[model samples]
Target: MSVVKPLPNYLVQRYRGWKATTYDNNKAWYRHLSNEGQHPRAMIISCCDSRVHVTAIFGADSGEFFIHRNIANLVPPYEPDGGRHGTSAAVEYAVTALKVAHIVVVGHSSCGGVKGCHDMCSGHAPALEEPTSFVGRWMDVLRPGYERVKDIEDEAERVRALEYEAVKTSIDNLMTFPFVKESVESDLLTLHGLWNNIAEGALEQLDPKTGSFVPV
Candidate 1:
């Protein structure tokens, strides 16, 4: 028998409520999207943190943005070694198939994945260093970012800096893909990096010229 369980009561009730209200009100739009298909303007790659609501933050409607969420919003260098690469696949589809004009990497403050990476890199979390640990292997993508920020004296500040590096690192890695690099060089696509301060509701955007994050 299939082991997948039904959604919990709260989520079921919430879905019903949404269907009754929001879905009901937007039936025409939903139908149009279903029939015509989605033609989103941008692709947003963000951390899988529950607190970072990508759609809500930008007030984006359904089919407005193609989004992919992963731990620390990381993008690994292009390695076409016949490996199972979910993030890379998503990016490939977005750029090649969907033809998205912009690709945004969104990182957030107080990200658990970023914290875990920080701890692991600093030698405070030995468990994450184990070869068998899936999270450890995944977080290895951010080690270079951690190396850049390891010298920061303050613990909180260092973690925060690492968070920014995560965004920068992903953007840098994105260019490693030949398709992405070609599109960028042809001026057909653009890249953006953003960091959101969860509590303060503040957003900072990366300035490509200065390599700094400034308030948006």
Candidate 2:
């Protein structure tokens, strides 16, 4: 017998209700999506924070965007070494197989992973520095971003700057992938960096010319 148990009755019931209502409201759209498969124009890499709600922010529908969510929305530098790189794998698939026209890296305010990196790098969260800590290891991707803002005198401004840096860092790393770079050079793919303010409901886009984040 399988070790897994059925989902909690309340959650399952809620899903069933949604499925019924959605099917009744848009049966043909769902069927077409199943038959045609996804052809999303953009691939969005965002944080796994529940409060971010990317679809709602973009007003996107089911087949509009190919989204990948991970801690702090980080993308590690391209490494072709034979290792399990989940984020890299997703990027390769989106670029090579999907041929998406745009790739967006989205960072947000009050990101726990970014905060953890700040704390760990500043010597406040020693546990995150332990070798066996998965968060610590994963957050190594954001250490460079932390370094960029480590010297800021104000704590709040420092963290906010790092959050924006995290988005820029991921965009930089995305270009390290050969396929992504080639696509951009050929004018087939455009890379974008976005930072979202959760509490204020604000968005900022990176200005490539000036290398700064400006309100969107």
- Candidate no. 1 TM-score: 0.98
lDDT of the candidates, in the order given: 0.97, 0.94
TM-score of each: 0.98, 0.96
Cα lDDT tens digits, model 1, 1-216, are: 599998999999999999999999999999999999999999999999999998999999999999999999999999999999999999999999999999999999999999999999989999999999988899999999999999999999999999999999999999999999999999999999999999999999999999999999
Clashing pairs in 1: none
Q: Which candidate wins on TM-score?
A: 1
Error of 1 at 156 (Å): 1.0
Q: How many residue pairs clash (N, CA or C atoms closer than 3 angstroms) in each of the candidate models, in the order given? A: 0, 0
**Residue runs of model 1 more than 4 Å from their true location after superposition:** none
